[model samples]
Target: MAVAAPQTSEGQPPKIKASAASLIDVGSGQIYFQKEGDKRREPASLTKIMTAILAIEKGDLKDVVTVRKRAAAVSMGQDIGLKSGDKLYLEDLLKAALMYSANDSTVAIGEHIAGEHDLFVKMMNDKAKSLGMKNTNFANTNGFHHPNHYTTANDLAILTSYALQNETFAKIVSTEEAVITWLPDEESKSVTENGEEKPLKQRTIHSTNRLLRSDYQGINGVKTGTTPRAGNCLVASAAREGRQLAVVILNSNNRWNDATRLLDYGFKEVRPVVLAEKDELVTELEVREGLEKRVSLVALERLEVYVPRIEVEKIQRKVVLTPAPEAPVKRGDKLGKMKFYLDDKELGAVDLVANQDVDRLSWFKRLFDKS
Candidate 1:
């Protein structure tokens, strides 16, 4: 594939066209590149991604949700034709909201999770803040047109990072299509306002993420959105070989094309490189007081980093040990940090914990610990 023209005099900065975008390596959990990425902008339907994540994590998929009047009132964009009292499973609503961009389904999930859209929006902000998305704010769950429902591409990426870690969230985000059928036990049969109500039968919801159906292989699920103010936005993920990566595009003329381009760049330049190995002694330091020898530290998470192949030489790692404790040591107690440096810049680091806990020296052992 053709690359964007370089931006720096050192070389080309890869010709990538996007309104606001971020490409990250999931395996390494690194933001490889960004452009207009931190600027706050309207999110539109991208809000459903977080809604899906929260629902899949906390709400029961099989539980039925009775559509409420508030949710039905949101009929501007795509909707699942929800009536005031029609019952659908949490899973179906999730698919409808995520796959079909159904505003009704989005509201259903939001209200079910927190019992109110306003309250759930608070949860969304709280969750976003917890994920370090300082530039994000939520006005509603369905991402409907609102003046204050805004977020940055980078903040959305941070939220995606947290969501992708959850298997259920990953599954829902990655799902391309779902065929939903009512449970045999659904008690109340509801009517459709369009003069027809099928008996909660099978209905298919196609994923809004066109990448799921496109040339990009190993694609996990994600969400797509568009609005007059937001244009086209997407948070897409794909796996290549063994590693996975997520790309977030906030506003683009060609959302699908931009997402694919970003992903291609990730696979080519921002390739996954192991940053740390499990059980590998990353940092070793002296023990304050212990029955055994000096304590060694290891990474809690495998140090994986994604960087441009050209920049690999620029990537250097150094293990930084915390100050030695002054007293008795216990196994598995955190004592230091393992820092991976890139071109003298700290790229990322994981906590270093005591690989093996040590027992305090007994009274007799302390006296004899002269050696």
Candidate 2:
């Protein structure tokens, strides 16, 4: 079988899947390579990722939400069989929406968060715009097919970057399966919904993400989506040897295969090398009028770098350290920044932390400290 060569026009490298995509180096906010990552495409249930985040941020998990007609309206895609007027807690609804891609759960969660479906959709678009997702829009929280509901692979990646900041949101998304049990009714005397609480046993829920399963190593929670127009999309992350990587793929025919390819590429082709370790001093700052002559400065967080191993030798790296003046500096002050560069391009920056407290110099010491 003859393998097709890359198409070229004016002596340029053949175009890869510009319509496909990936994003890596999560912490440093670096994009190794991408295809039509910014191209507008259907998000499918991956829209639930944003819905989950919004619920986490704006809705109280303990709050009660009586499923409304709109919430229980006949919808399409993944569902948890919610009925009209069904009573459930915010937490359960969130789990359902995220794990099962329940359209009802999405509507219910949206209502609970933004007080209405329309408003919740607005927030989704607003957040997308704020994240610089210039080519995205949201008409519903459930990600059902709509003429206007659209998002890009890069936009999804950006959303993941912000969504992971919420620790709880991050945990729930990555969970393989969760058993969610709640009282059929918050009160025994309360009207029964879902055929009574029935002794309140754990109802197990499994994660759609296989990476979080025991079979896979270093894989954690993220989101996945598929639609006729969007194909298969995934925003996934994994941690190995003290390094974490987030990968996003869009417009793929084979969802799992694309995810595997991107993740394998990250681990094999562009694993994050430890440019600097936590608490490792990259430089020192001279204390002008403090008890110590100098203060050690180190990276606040572990510095893991992601780059193509094939380009490892060619991947030039440099650290720019900005040390703060020592005098009157409090312990743990964010005095400076550590910037790591690869191949003349600024890859990322981490906040440099002060090693210790620097007390104000005494009158006598202040006058003679410079001497």
Best by lDDT: 1
Global CA lDDT computed for model 2: 0.71
- Provide the global lDDT of candidate 1 against the true structure: 0.76
What lDDT is reached at residue 160 by model 2?
A: 78
User: Which sections of candidate 2 miss by over 4 Å?
Assistant: 1-19, 181-204, 271-304, 311-345, 349-371
lDDT of 2 at 186: 50
Model 2 TM-score?
A: 0.69
Compose the digit string of candidate 1's lDDT tens values, residues 59-103.
898888877899878778888777777677898888788788888
Q: Per-residue alpha-carbon lDDT of model 2 for 1-371, expressed as tens digits? A: 11232243433223334256756655655666567777778888889988888778777889888777888885676667666767778888888877656777889788777888899899988878887888888998877889999887777777777787788887778776766654455555333586543644345667666556534556776877777777767778877776566777776655554555565556555655676678878777877767887887888888666776655566544545554474788777776777766657776677777889888789887778557
Provide the clashing-pair count of each candidate structure: 13, 9
The local lDDT score (0 to 100) that residue 349 gets in candidate 1 is: 81
